[model samples]
Every structure is written in structure tokens, then in C-alpha cells.
Target: MAKPQVRYVCQSCGSIQSKWMGQCPDCQGWNTLEQEASQAATPFANKHNLRGGGRRIELASLSSEIEPAPRRPTGMTEFDRVLGGGLVPGCAVLIGGDPGIGKSTILLQAAARIADNGGSVVYISGEEAVDQVRLRADRLGVAQSPVQLGAGTAVRDILTTLESQPAPTLLVIDSIQTLYSDQLEAAPGTVSQVRAASHELIRYAKTSGASLVLVGHVTKDGQIAGPRVLEHMVDTVLYFEGERSHAFRILRAVKNRFGGTDEIGVFEMQEKGLAEVTNPSALFLTDRDRPVAGSVVFAGVEGTRPVLVEMQALVVRVPSGATPRRAVVGWDSSRLSMVLAVLEARCGLAFSGHEVYLNVAGGLRIGEPAADMAVAAALVSALLDRPMPNDLVAYGEIALSGEIRPVSQSAARLKEAAKLGFTRAFVPPRGNSGREIATVEFPTLAALVDHLTDGL
Candidate 1:
């Protein structure tokens, strides 16, 4: 028999080393190496077949008629929105977020809803005791729902207890990092343990035809805490994001096998729990009837949903000795700088001695470049102290050559803006996209600047 040896492993990048070191060579993280059992073959000799020992699998044709996968609705519209309608049977979902981001709270409420809808659900928490989860359920007013709860960290024990019963409709594992397999000598939350436990849990879901949801802790960089392969092993990966001080939360889907990616679910936290915000566009726009300088409504699209959000800008003169500052809230700071430079070089609008600040109203983050024209409008409006018409909306991409470019889904943007009672829209020059509102096209950045400052 061969004896097991120990080796050092980098927890940050999942790199294995022959010996321990103060710093990891792969990720350059200090003091992140941990000792684990080595899988080297010594004198151990267990002979088996050199090849072929599994059952033959049957193949199916693409044209064959097949029943579609059934969806289990948890009765939460916002939750279902992100999952692309509802949860599919045998789907494995990985939800990651920062500490105290309400990941656990939302999952508990979901499990209770599923149970109330006549579906059997099991919630196994490795991080909290059964009583603790029950207390939270009671606080959320869902204690009456018949959801089977268990608290354990041993993967073997968990699988064993689940073997004697029928397959549940839904299974939740609170934190896969806390689960440790007896097959591996490594401690819980290590890379090897997380990978092995997730594999087993996902396999169970596949074989039993039950929906599985796994909660994951995030690293300081906001990524899930595990080997990158852990994310690849799941069918869906969701991220819960928001500022801790804010009441609104955004549940975004980065990867989904059964649905579209980049889809988002908006929720508001309150004393009752998380409530769904059905009309996110209306929630993001504030006092749209009253015109204000440096504030313009941007018709933007988040995934498949069209959203109208206010873009606010401020430009002020700084002292000769003080450096001008460029502060941003929810939009990219570099994009703002580019807009400022274009206004200066292309439209002759001086911003060198002026401090600039930009913010996207509501807690939502804007990533699309289609916001460039709206941002430019806000900057011009602010610098000239000219309030834009309350009935107008704008969206287009700007280039360094001072040209306005057409954005995708222009029709949707215009439709959303008009639905919000806006009568005018500024879009890039393109073939007429049929719209319900009055469209004012901008051929270049200079042209829009002329319109803003001509009579300021």
C-alpha cells in the first residue's frame, strides 16, 4: 500500500505546488497557499481494464418529437423574470453575491412559495442551523410553508439521507463551499472540495430530475469563490448586486442555458421582504414632467426590457490653483471624458477649466454606449444652464470623428420613451425605423451642440 503525501495548493488560482511558499506564483496572492493530501501513486497497485467498461448510450434524432421541459413557477414575478419565465426541471443554478446581499432571504421565500404551490422542496444549509433558517422564515411570514429543512456539512451524510425518499421538486444547497466530501482529505471551502461537492450535487439533480439551486460566496473581486470550473459546471449563473446603503437590488443573469443572458430582475427590500418592481422604467424616472438643466432622459435597453432613465450632469468652474475633477456615479468615467473632449475639440465648447460630474438616476448601472448622445445633451444643457424640453428623449452612440452612430433596437427605445409621454426623440441618422413619436435625427455631435447653445 502507498502512503498519502501532502502538497501545497494556491486557493486563489487553484494551482498546485510541490512545496509551500509565502506568495502564490500564479495569482500573486500572499499567504493563500494551503496544504492538502497528494494524489501521487506510490507502490499501490489496483489493476483494472485498460479500456471500455461503460454502458452503451442511445442517440436521438434532432427532428424527433419530444415533450418540452416543464417549468415550476415559484409565484415571484421578478424571480421568474430573470430565470426566463420559470425554473426548468433538472436545471442547476448557481447564485453568487456579496455578504448580506439578501441571497439567502430571497431563496427562502422562493422555497416557501414553491411548497405552497403543492411542490415538495428541500433546503439544506451548511452555513446556518435549521432553527436559524426557521427563524428567518418566521420573520418573512413564511413559516407555515412546508419546506423540509436540514443543516449539515458532510456531503456523504446529505446524499445518504436523500436517497431513501422520492425526488423533490426543488432542492437548495445554501453555500456549496461549506460542503466537504469524505473522499477528499482537504478541508471545506477549498477548491477541490467545492468542485467535488458541486459535481455530486449537480449529478443528483440530473439523475433525479429535480431543480437545484446552489448559493456561492463571492471573492473580494465580486467573483464566485471557487475554481472557475464551478461556474462552467452549472446550467445557470446569477449575480445579486446593489449598494448596501440602497434599497433596490438588481438580480442579473450572466449565464443561462435555458434562457437569455443579461436579463435582470429588479427588487426592492422592505420590512415585509423583497418586493418586485414590475415597471422598472417608471421607477427609474423621477419628476419627468418638470424640466431641469443638465438632466436628460435616456431611452436604454437592459436585456430585452426597454428602460428610460434620467442622466444628470453638472459642470462648474474651478479655481485657477485647483485641478478640475471628473466625478461619475453609475456610468463609465472614461466615456464621460471622451464626451467632454469631443465637445471641446469638435463643438468648441470649453470644458478645460470646468469641473464635470455625471450621474445615472436610480441605482441601476448603465453599460451601453447608446447613452452617449443623452449624456452629451445633459453636459451641454448643464454648461449653458438651459433646461431641455421635458417631452424629449435621446439615445445614440458617438464617435471620435464627431459622428452620431445608430444604436440597436432603436424602435424599442423610441416606443418606451413615447409610452412615458415623451413626444420627441433624438437618435442617430439611419433608415427610418418606424416610430410612434416625433423623431429628430442628429448627424453629428456638432449639430446637437448647435441646437443646445444656439439660443441658450
Candidate 2:
């Protein structure tokens, strides 16, 4: 038998190397390469025939009829919303978040709710003790819930115990990084171990018709720590995001095989547990008794839900020979720079000798391009020190040629704004905005600037 060959794998990018190096060649991450053992191929195995001996898979026709997957709703409405209605049997979910971001708390609450509803639930914690989980349950007022709890890090032992009994309706593995497989010599949380453990857990969920939810820890870059393949193996990938200084947490679905992506569920972290926020628009919108400069209401859509958030900007005149600073929060900084450039070149507004600051109120990040017009309005408002109408909302896409482009779901955005007592909307031309609110159409970025400067 040939001895096992030693290899170094980059934890950041999962690239394998012949030997260790100071920095990973693929990802340029310093000190991220770890030594791993790989079995060498034998001469007989290498020379094996390539003739197929396996069974072929059956192909299905595109016209074939299929029933929708059955869903089991956890009592938590926000959690169920993120899961595309509810949890589907045999569905594998991967939820990743930062440290102390309430990933475990939300899962535990869901587990308790399922158990209380007469569904079987098994929560296996790899990082915490059973007593600690019990203490948390008590704190959350769920101590009486009959949730089967266990603490283990060995994947084989956990599977063996799970297989001995009937399959549970919900199976939760808290922190997949801590689980290790005895078949691999690599340490837990390494690339090999996480991949192997996750594969085993996902396979078990598939065969046993149980829903699997895996909690994952994130890296400093806010990405799930482990091999990237782990995300592809799961049915749905959820990200729990929120700032530490804020009480609001946003659960967003980045990828979902069963439902639409970009769906978000809002939750508020409380002393007891995570509470669902039904009116998320209220949480993201600030109370404004009077019109304020640099503050604009943005009618945005998150997944299928229309959200109204406050866009705040600040522009300060800088002295000569000093570099102008551009600061942004909860919005893309590059996009901010692009919008500034367009305002300068296309709209004839100068921001060269000014420091610009942009923030999306309530710590909610806005990604859609529909926010471009709202951001531009805020910047121009701040620079000119002109307060916009308190009940006005803005949303549209800005083009490089200064033309204001129409966005999708304009009616939906308008309806949401109208529901929030907004009477006027600043939108692109030729868009169908509902009659509930009055809309002022802008043909170009210059038109918007004119409306803000002269019309307002």
C-alpha cells in the first residue's frame, strides 16, 4: 500500500497545494493553508477500466405533472416567510451569520414551536452543552416544549443515534463547523471535515424525509466559513444580517430551489428571543414631524414585499487643499461614487470640494438599482440645503446618459408609499404608478435636479 500523501489546502479558497506557503496563491490569504492528508492512488486503481457498470438515471419529460411539495409551517410567521411559506420535508437548509447574530436563537425558537405543535424535533448542538440549551429555552419561556436535545460533535455517532429511532420532522444541527467525521484525519471546521459532515447530514435528511437546518458560522468577510460547495448542496441558503448596535435583524434568502430568491423576513431581537416584525416598513422608516434636508423617503421592494425606508445624505463643503471624504452606510459605496459622478457630469451639480455621507436609516441595506434616484435626490437635497416634501417618495433607475429609466413594479412601490400616507412620488416617465398618489415624472437626471432646486 502506498503511504498517504500530504497536501496543504487553502481554507479561504479551498485550493490544494503541494506544500505550505506563507500566503495562498489562489486567494492571497495569509496563513490560511492547512496541512491535510490525501490517500495516494495505487497502480491497479489508476489502470482500472473506464467501462461503465452503473445503472442509468431515468429522465422525466418537461410536460409531466407534479404536485407541489408539502410544507409544515413553524409557528413563527417571519421564519416561515423566509422559507418560502414553510419548511418542506426532505429540504436541506443552510443558515449562516456572524457570531451572536441570533442564528441559534431563531432556530431554537422554531424547533420549540414545531415540538409544541406535536411535530417531532431534534436539536443537536455541537458547540453548546445540553444544559446551556436548556437554560436558554427557559429564558425564552420554552422550557416546557418537548424538544429532544443532544450535544455531540461526532457525525457518525449522531447519525447512528438518529437512525435507531423514527425520523424526526425537523432536524437541526447547530454550527456545522464543529462536527467532525472519524473517517477523515483532518480536524473539525477544516475544509474536508465540514464537507464530509454536511454531506452526511444532508444525505440523511434526503433519505429519511426529514427537514434539515444547518447553522453555519461566517468569516470576517461575512461569508459562510467552510467549503463553498456546502451552500450548493443545500436546498435553501439564508443569511441572518444585522448590525450589533441595532435591534433589527434581517433574514434574507440568497438562494432557494423551492421558492424565489431575495425574499426577506424581519425580526427584532428582544430580551426573551427574536420577535417577528410584521410591519417592517415601520421599523426602517424614521419619524419625521417636519421636512428635513438630506432626508428622503425611498419606496423600495424587498422580494415581493414593498418596503419604505428613509435615505439620508450629508454634504459638507471642504476647505482648499483638503481631500473630500465620501462615507456610506448600509448602501454600496461604489454606487454612491457613480451617482455622484453622474450628478456632476450630467446634472451640472458639483461635489468636488465637499464631503459626502449617505446612510440608509435603521441599518437595512438597500441593493436594488431602483434606489439610485432616491440617493441622488438625497444628495442634491443635502447640498442645496432644501428639504423635500415630508410625504414624497422617490424610486427609479439612473442611466449613464442622464436619462431616468423606469423600474419594475412601479405600481407596487406607489401603492406601498400611499399606504404610508405618502401623497406624491418622484418616478421615471412612462411608468404606471397607481392613482392612489400623485406622481411627478422626470425624463432626465437634470429634470430631477431642476425639480429639487426650482420646483420644490
Candidate 3:
């Protein structure tokens, strides 16, 4: 028998070190290092090393015919969309979000629907009691479903009970942090325990061809709380995002092996449960009863969907010698600074003593750079006290050299804006449509500035 070697590992990043340190050198996270056992090296045998003959392995061509992995629909279109149409068999999904952001609510609803649709579902809660889960199920109107429920913390006990029952179509673990394997001396949620527990459960899921859903806890910085390897081990990773002041939640897929990544599914939080938002653009648009300065509609793409969101800007004069502050919400502040620099350097504008604030309405964050033109237009409109047309929308990317770049899915953007009763659009040069809506194409950011400041 040989003694196992001890190694220190960072819980946040899974970086191993020979000795412990107060701060992790890799991730710079403080107080995250934990002790774990390193397996001893196996002894070599003369007979095994001398053996030459071995079994041959089979190989397959790239064009070989085989049946595709079957997918089971969770009965919710929004959930299915984030999982890439449907949940593939043996797929492991990890979903993380802010506390009280409805991570459990949505999963419970989906589990009930799967049970109702003649599929077996077993929901195991490690944090909440069985009765507490039942109360939530009743509130979500899913208590009548035939879904088996249990509350436990030990991974060994959970696997033991699951081994006796027939393989279920779907298995949900409320959280991975709460399960601790008996084989390890480390506590639950530690690096070694979490890794070992996840590996064991995932191995079982693969052997049984069952889809596994793991709800993950998020840190204060909004990242999943665990070793980085947890995300890599899973087939798909999802982030449930929402503003506390907002009513809607965005389920985004950052990684998916079976489906398209960068896809988003919209859901609105209500009393009953999470309701799918079929037309999210309508909810993000502002009321057009009266045209207001510093407000412009931006035609943007969320995943494959064309969404119209309102962009607002406010420019105020700052006292001399005071550094002008730039505050932005729901959009990138660095990008806003770049747009402002182009406006001042290329468009002959003076914003030295003016404070700038920009916001994307509806609490929906806009990451696509296509909204650059709209943001620029709104800033200029606010600075000049000129209101843009209520029926006008903008979509284009602006470069530092004062050029307006064309974005992808032009037709999709224009069609969505026109359908929402926008009669005019300001987009990048070319890709115009034959619709009744008039389109003004800006070849450069200077041209956009000229139109917004001089032509207005």
C-alpha cells in the first residue's frame, strides 16, 4: 500500500499547487484553495509490460450511416429552444443564475410537463425539503403530475436509490454543490467532492442514456460557483439572466455541443410560473405617443431573432474643470466611449464639458454592435435637443475611422422594424429592401453625424 499525495487546489478555478497560498495565482481569487488527495502512481508489473498481443479496435468513416441521437422535448418551446430544439438523450446541462432569479421555478415546471407527457422524471433537491418543493410545485400548478421527488444531500444515497428504479427520461439535480461523495473526506461543494460527484452522476447518466440537468450556484461576480472543469464536463451550459427590476428573464446558451451556441430564450416571470415571451421585441419597445429627444429605436439581433429595442441618451453640461462622466446601462460603456470619440474627432463636435448617459430600455442588455448607429444618433439628438422621428429605426456598426460597417441579417432587421410600424430606417450602406418603408443608408459615421446634427 502506498500513501496518497496531498495537493492544494483552487476551488474557483481548479488550479493545483504544491503548497497552499492565500490568493490563487491563476484566478486571483482569495481564500479558494483547498486540500485534496492525489492518487498514488500504480506499480508496474513485468508480466503486464511484457505482454504484446492486444485486441484490435474498430474504426468508422466520416460518412458512415448511423441513427442520430434522439431528443426529448420538455414541453416548453422556450426551454427547448435554449437546449437547441430539444434535450438530447444523455446530454448534461448546467444552468446558473442569480439568487431568487427563478432557476428552480422554471426547472420544476419543465419537469412536471415532461412527466405529464408520458416521460419519467425524477427531481432531486439537495437544498430544499421535499415538502417545500411540493409547495412550489403546487404554486406552479404542477403538483398533479406524476414526477417522483426526493430531498437528499449524499451523492451515494441518491445513486443507490436511482440504481434500483428504471432509468428515467429526465433527472434533475437541484444543485451540484450540495452533493458530497462518501469516498472523499472533503465537504460538500468543495473542489474534489464536486468533481467526483459530478463525474459519477454523469457517468451513470451516459450509461443509462438519460438527460441530466444540474442547477449551479453562482458567485457574487455572476459566475458559476465551482471549478472551471464543471462547465467543460457538461454538454451544454446555460445562464439565466434578468434584472431584478425587470419582469422578464433571458435564458442564454453560452456553450452547446448538440445545438447552436449564443442562442437565447425569453421568459417572463409571473405568478403562475415562467411564461414564454413569443414577441420579446414588443415588450422592449417604448411607447410612441409623442416623439422625444434622445430616444431612438434600435433594430438588433438576439441569437437568430430580430429584436427592436429603444435606446435613450442624456447629455448634460458639466462645470468647467470637472471631468465629464460617462454612464451607460444595458450597453457596453467602452463602446460608447469609442462612439463618442468618433463624434468629437471626426464629426467636429465638442463634448469636453458635457456628461453623457445612455440606456437601453426594458432592462434588456444589448451586446450586438449593430446598435452603434442608434446610440450615436440618440446621443446627438439629446445634445442638440432635437427629437428623432418616432417611426425611424437605426442599425449599423461604427468604426474608429468614421466608417459605418454593414451588419449581418439586414433583411431580418428591416422586416422586424417594418412589421412594428416603423416606416423609415437608417442602416449601413446597401442591403435595402423593396418594401414601402424608406431606408437611409449611412456610408460612414461622419455621414450619420451630419444627418443627425446638420440635416435634422
Judging by TM-score against the true structure, name the best candidate.
2
The superposed Cα distance between candidate 1 and the true structure at residue 300, in angstroms, equals 0.9
Residue pairs of candidate 3 with colliding backbone atoms: none
| Segments in model 2 whose C-alpha atoms lie over 4 Å from true places | 1-51
**Model 3 Cα lDDT, one tens digit per residue, 36-125:** 998763454333553545767798899988897778999999899889888888889999999999999999999999999999999999
The alpha-carbon RMSD values of the candidates against the true structure, listed in the order shown, are 10.7, 10.6, 10.6
Off by over 4 Å in 1: 1-67, 431-435
> What is candidate 2's local distance difference test score?
0.94
Model 2 compared with the native: what TM-score?
0.89
User: Candidate 1 lDDT, tens digit per residue, 365-409?
Assistant: 999999999999999999999999988889999999999999999
lDDT of 2 at 101: 90
| lDDT (tens digit, per residue) of candidate 2 on 107-182 | 9999999999999999999999999999999999999999999999999999999999999999999989999999
User: In candidate 3, which residue ranges exceed 4 Å CA deviation?
Assistant: 1-57, 434-436
Better of 2 and 3 by lDDT: 2
lDDT per prediction?
0.91, 0.94, 0.91
